[model samples]
Target: MTNAGAEGEPPLDAESLAFLNRPGLTRLWAAARTRLERGGLQPTGTIRLQNLDAQEREALSLLLARPVTGPTATIRLPDLDIRLRASAVGRGLAATLAELGPPLTDRRAARNAAQAERIRLWSAAETTLAATPLAGQPWARPWLEEIRRGGTLTRQPSGTALTTVTQAIDTLATLFPGTTPGPAPATWGRGELATRTTGSAHGLDDGTLLARLVLRGIAAARGADVPTDAPGRRALWRRASVIPDEVSSTVLTYGLRPRGGTWGEKTLRERADRALETHLTLRELRTLRLNMPPGTRVHVCENPRVVEAAADAGCTAPLVCTSGSATTVVLTLLDALATAGCAFAYHGDFDWTGIALANRIMERYRAEPWRMTAADYEYLATRAELHGTPSLPLAGPQVAAVWDAELAPIMEAFGVALHEECALEPLLGDLE
Candidate 1:
């Protein structure tokens, strides 16, 4: 009987032992051995080894001391010839049989399956949140459902009060045990906490988010981790000023004014000129108003060129150009005009872009839409021989909930764009 070595005994030729010393060679032999054990080769009992180089065959022969047969030749090893033949034959048979079976999955199918699973998870979460009863404030149920569905809520709830972060965490945990809530504000800083609270507010304006991000960026620039709800952050922004006056002047100028301050005719005229020359926004408008003259008439124009032309024409009425959205300066000037009781008439291009901008100004500052009606658009469409390049597509996502719903459809129908210059004469007529 051949004695196998004791379990703990070291081999006499430790360096040459394939399984113990050379992991790579041992792995190859084990894989071949497994195929032999599994009956994966061609014949039920015989192994037909192929794809082996002469060196690998010699190694196998030395390791097993077996007789191995391949497609080209049969090499006999004294002790293991039968085993090697069986392993190879089994591997070859399995490969041949697999080729005759059903097809394997392709890449597209795997991707689609993964996407379908993600949708299923998202849908399940939506359904679960919708059904769950929100305690205390019944109206919170819909808002919570919206959040679960990944929709942002900007308006404050008029019905039921909204849930707190702690309550939200609990409710979410019940629905999605796999998810963990993020760290509380105290972990990072007070400023971060304030920002998170403002974001989660059911009644916060959409602009609040933009303001928060801007403030946080400023805090980061100052090497501070700003809290989400930091009063300090707000105060810092209030104190900070933007140069050249155009950017910061508007919000600051209009924003700083007392609600009912009288802006007389003289005040409006002085303020409008100061705003144009200095590019002051609503905020800066407040500072300039202290010593402004009375009973000034402000002329509002859509194009900066109109403002320039008015100035060049020596028109004395205080003039302003929207330049696009009512910048802080524009809003400030409008607000000052309103306070001073100065009548304002606005005019812009008769195209869709003009209509949209007019709508935004009307909504944001309660400014009357200056000659931006459907009639105005139709009249301009017929009169202008050389219209500006067809109104370009809108820059960002359209918020139809607040905007003129007919504007997009009108632009699509016209298939052409008109600029402020096309309607310049009629607008100037209104000014005269």
Candidate 2:
């Protein structure tokens, strides 16, 4: 019989096979493993083994039943198969290698897997960044750098969930008053804004994951605090005219009397202890038709406490509290007042967020900066420093103060926060 006659005999036992695959011929084994993983073992195929040692050459000589020439040898798979069947007591070369050790992964396959993973992460990040309104603004670069450092706004791991976040941000960004004064910021019903921006009304509803990502980004861009509750989120959205859940998003005012309504007039007359805490909704503001006497100065405050104090002092200051960020209703009233040639004097907390709000208010309503100046901040900061109360650290993102350019530097130097309440006594004195 030929040397290949033993077809029914069992292959070498596991222990002998293990010794055969030990460190000596590791390079040859690795080459065979790659070939097997890429394109399964077959007769008439060739594989090259490099840097062969004496032990490896001997192993190869025994396996192939032929002498190897040198350090490198291109072994024919068919020849190895015949040799393995005849001498190694195996059916084929594949069966012999299987008895030797575990299978190895192809290097090319591993590289492709890694490349695909990188693509997925970048695709999600790029999509979200491009959709944010700040994408074209100065803050976009730093914000993107923050994201690239693995500060993901959404905890979602799936591509579909991240894409949903991107869509929501796009919807909200489109609502922020566009630069260069195009069409008025699209103030639609909450549902309408979602549908127009993303193709579904429920896409940006409150309590959703997408909603949280969008809200956080909005607060970041505006240098405002990250809202914690439903009311807080609504206030943030309203500030941008995004109007998420518009019906519930209302602006609180103490003394806002427009010429159209007898009630508005009545509210203005019944000032003092009977302050009108009018809460105007999105729908009401959109359809609102009110006018004020020309050159009227409407005093705007950031806090309800200031407005409440103004009302209690019986100051008759024509005060309007933005409550937090100016909601759609506040903006609507201010816009109407501006149309009738009313001037606005806005005051807010003396901090980064406050300065940002002051800038936005003055720019939008052509309002003058009221007690929101370098002098104002410096006076408050100096008093606090002298009294051993250094004020809270200047937190939130840095924003430039166009109204008083030096105000930003003074705030940075002092690292103090002067809230509207801190200067409440002086503000009330001004009202009188």
Candidate 3:
């Protein structure tokens, strides 16, 4: 930099080469550069040179034209600037540092620019969601916070984060459309909802960035944790009225007939007559008729084996099996059955997941907990071989038992999972 142009400083002359290239002066110049750069290239404050060697002191004395002797010395930028301009350097400090290798950067300015860009990104995002139902909801803040914390929004190119936010808000807004306190939106296929809101059929598909973001909002709004598995994800979407295809989303049933002559009712009557099981889809249930009289107790279970057991035992109380996690079709069937004046006796496994399913059924449908209580868990847990099966260890996160408050804590204490199959004999007796 002695002979070449300084970094953001005026070009240096041959006469200043000795001073710019002088030994022991590197530390002073580096400190000055750092100070000025840190101050955003605007301040001319003092820079301290600590533990000065003989060369540094001599260089400083020569540069400042003072008898410098101390181990530390504070050099003022204004003095250096004046000296640099008048001396053979022929320019101020900025240009001089530029002539030196590695150009100076205004770190403060860089930070400010980045911050402004972030503000602009989110402000535009707010404008993007201004018209949606999500704009001012309580869950919106947490969603935005999670997005911010995850760093997904800021890790990409400009405008991309906003695009992501817009997609999530648009998809969510569509999934739960209409004013607050209104009826639930009609269920739609996952792809169809994604296409309508985000212009991509797979916009909200599982494992997609948009899917994760959207699920976070759904969980936050519902005060639930973000779903992690395929079944869990589908369940969350189903709760939001987004469903799989009618064919893919079906509920298993066995026994007892509705009085109506519609396809579902006739199918139920025929299935019950033969003691066979039938799986009903939303499409079929939508058009098929049913006429369950008031107080008609339809049994609901979380596993298909229960329905199988009921069928095998010739138990004809009309069982609906969730087959694991209850799908949208299962929920719709339950709602329809409830509308038709059918009471429900819901049973599930005795593990944490089963308890969760029971909570949802009990909370949503007011169904009675069938063989799903603290007493039932304790009785089943005590016998290693209940219903000819060994008791399994409870796995997964604990869920609150809304139907019976003591059920969750009891299960936690026992650390045993009494599956519905283990209670099959008694359940079969009840069914008969």
Top-lDDT structure, candidate number: 3
Please provide TM-scores, in order, for all candidate models, with all chains considered together. Answer: 0.38, 0.49, 0.54
lDDT of 2 at 377: 85
RMSD of each: 18.3, 14.9, 11.7
For 1-432, candidate 1 gives per-residue lDDT tens digits of 112232343222323332222332343434434443354232333234456666555555555555334423232222243443354222232232222232223335555665565455445444544554323323334444444354222132311112322233233333222212222222322233333544433222223433443343334334455555423443434332211112333321211112235553344445444433324543345455533345444456677777655544544455567876665456656765677665555666555566666766666555555656556665666565354435443343332313345654655555555677766666666554
Query: Per-residue lDDT for 1-432 in model 3, tens only?
Result: 435574455456565766676887999888988998888885488999899999999998988888889999998898888987787767778777777657889989988988888888777767766777776576776677668777787777767777888888887777656544132557788888888878888787678888888888777767777877665776777777777555766888887688886666777898899999988877787676677767889989888888888888888787889887866778878888888889899889888888877888888899998888789888888775545655578888889888888988988998888778888888899998
Task: Report residue 236 deviation for candidate 3 (angstroms).
Answer: 18
In terms of TM-score, which candidate is strongest? Answer: 3
Candidate 2 — what's its lDDT? Answer: 0.68
Candidate scoring better on TM-score of 1 and 3? 3
lDDT of every model, 2 decimals: 0.43, 0.68, 0.80
Candidate ranking under TM-score, highest first, comes to 3, 2, 1
Better of 2 and 3 by TM-score: 3
C-alpha RMSD in Å of predicted model 2 compared with the true structure:
14.9
Instruction: Quickly count the clashes in candidate 2.
Output: 0
Write down the TM-score for model 3: 0.54
Off by over 4 Å in 2: 1-245, 260-273
Q: Candidate 1: global Cα-lDDT?
A: 0.43
What's the lDDT of the predicted structure labeled candidate 3?
0.80
